[model samples]
Target: MSHSPAPRRRIPAPRPADGFMLLLEAARDLRTVGAVAPSGKALARALTEPVRAQAGQPLDILEAGAGTGAVTRTLIPQLAPGSRLDVAEANPRFAHRLSELVRAHPHLAGRPPEQVRVHDVHVERLETGRRYDVIVSGLPFTNFSPHHVEAIMDRYLELLRPGGTLTYFAYRGTGRARALLASPAQAHRHRAVERLLAAYRDRCATGRRTAWANLPPATVWQLRRPAYAVEHSGTRAATAEGAGGAGGVPGPAGVPRTGL
Candidate 1:
């Protein structure tokens, strides 16, 4: 009997934490002189829950200012079998580290390099031809100037296809918007988010702030682009119905989470 040729050797899956050291090094080189980092656990929650709420639909996601893959790590497991994600980061060091992290994850193994795209450019500088179904951001909103904040907000809002969701979190304690306003640099960031959201309040399907139990007590802001005939209300409502009180506005629970 002829002996069969030796089987080809299979490569081991990548380690999820290989880039941990690199991520820390990159963090040290960021432009943020003293920005407070969001708690990893809270950041993870902010990334995962939105996918669950969307029922793990195969869709496009845009993440801004992804530092060291904290949020991406949490989001990967929550994605549908073939979901695609794009990260837009201003810090080159952090961006490079993020790219390395994806390559090291077991779930990300065997995928084409293009499966994960990273843009090492300012969020404001990105001009992607494609729109996204969801946009997750950890930008330093509380530290930007009003103009900068407005610009970023308007740009992202324009990028969102109708009915898309934009999820973000703001610090509440020492790093909170209210507290940050005491300093000029951080104050700009706070005002920008306020102005931008106020300008587009009516077009959101779910606009609520969640007070996190995590350290620094941050607040999470989540908004979804509205379908036809939907409008932004001035006040914060617990659910869509609350915002549309007496008029049968849809609630967050019933709104089908799908890409526009």
Candidate 2:
């Protein structure tokens, strides 16, 4: 007796990272519930490619304003073994949740406890004198003023390690209805974002190239000191000393000093 051929078996499809669009929905809802600005997941996704290209080996990432660790959640699994992570969040409640998430996940558990510091302090305050090999941020620069933008930029300049990279993004396109819904103060906020981007152009190691594939489209800024530059401390010292002296010529107008 011949047995009938077994019915064709269907292979299960692969699931997207964090359940795909559902993950995006959850991230969107988190921002909505908090009445915060748009989450930069699209930008964060766009950054992954560049980060992989630049980092080569496993990356030691410092993520600011991780929210529910949406971006962090996506990024950590992609990293290689022995890579470290340090996260700083301004919201205590969210920070606590992030801590819990790290504990709950196996991939995240590999990182050291000391690496994650969930403080309720702003980036500028938390980053002073601390340095990171790679910094990923989701802070809403569009909510800040021009001076506040400059202040944040100064912090980035100091806190990013030589040969390190920094990645952050903002939403640039909005419909008329969305614009009308935005507060009257948004115009100034927009200017703040523009100025911050201008600084990125002037300072970032990656220059002005942008990633066009993201949902809202975003610019990526990557900065790194040259190998020779990193090895030569004497030249940097001379510039530092000259800039510090009372008689030295001034830098660009409104560039701000370490404390200003």
Candidate 3:
């Protein structure tokens, strides 16, 4: 007998209670929460654009710092059959919430049980040998020190397979806002992070988009790994210098949750 393929799943509206819990978490620990509110639908869509572009092909995906699963909800439905998604969150509370989200998400109901997975540790500690085709990040780079940011970024590029994409967002006006209220030392840290990011942007950036419908407007950037990912000239030596190969993105000694 011949039969039609199952219809694609539609996204469900977020629940009020979920939003409330997210707000509470953010209030309790703004440093790890990233935003006071869950990622708006528009922003979620923007961040998941890379996955949509790879429709019909199986892929390995990673979503780091998924504070409340707003972005997770959008990402799961877009994954092609046989695709794998690993969500890494450092905060135990947020991680628990994400685990629940994965179990209850309608779109993931009939897929392979392992299609979606969550880790309660930092992204830097995720234990995986598979190279990812895409990585969607929700971490707040501005919250951590420059060295931490660099390590995280380096780990991300390393985990990606050749020509893979990495997407992430930063709240709009953060630079100006920080300059006005941050201490001189704090401001310096932000500058150092920016300079580090600028170097990568110059080398690997593909495109960027502004999502205005979010609480605090944000910009999403997409960067592609060089075609020769394993042998990129500049990064080859660095990746060899005792860098945590595949299972982890080693943190600087004494640094906790380096960038996730």
- Pairs that collide in candidate 2 are 205-223
lDDT tens digits by residue: candidate 3, 28-114: 877667687789988999999989998988999999999878999888878788899999998888788888778877778778889
> In model 2, which runs have C-alpha deviations exceeding 4 angstroms?
1-42, 54-58, 109-111, 115-117, 127-130, 174-185, 205-219, 223-260
User: In order, how many clashes per candidate?
Assistant: 8, 1, 0
Model 2 lDDT per residue over 209-258, tens place: 45575555656655543222222111111112122111111233423222
Best by TM-score: 3
Per-residue lDDT of candidate 1, residues 91-164 (tens digit):
77678877777766666666666666888987778877877788888776644544455457656766777777
Worst lDDT run of 10 residues, candidate 2, spans 232-241
TM-score of every model? 0.68, 0.63, 0.82
Model 1 misplaced regions, further than 4 Å: 1-34, 174-211, 228-260
Task: Identify the runs in model 3 with alpha carbons over 4 angstroms from their true place.
Answer: 1-13, 229-260
Give the TM-score comparing model 2 with the true structure, all chains together. 0.63
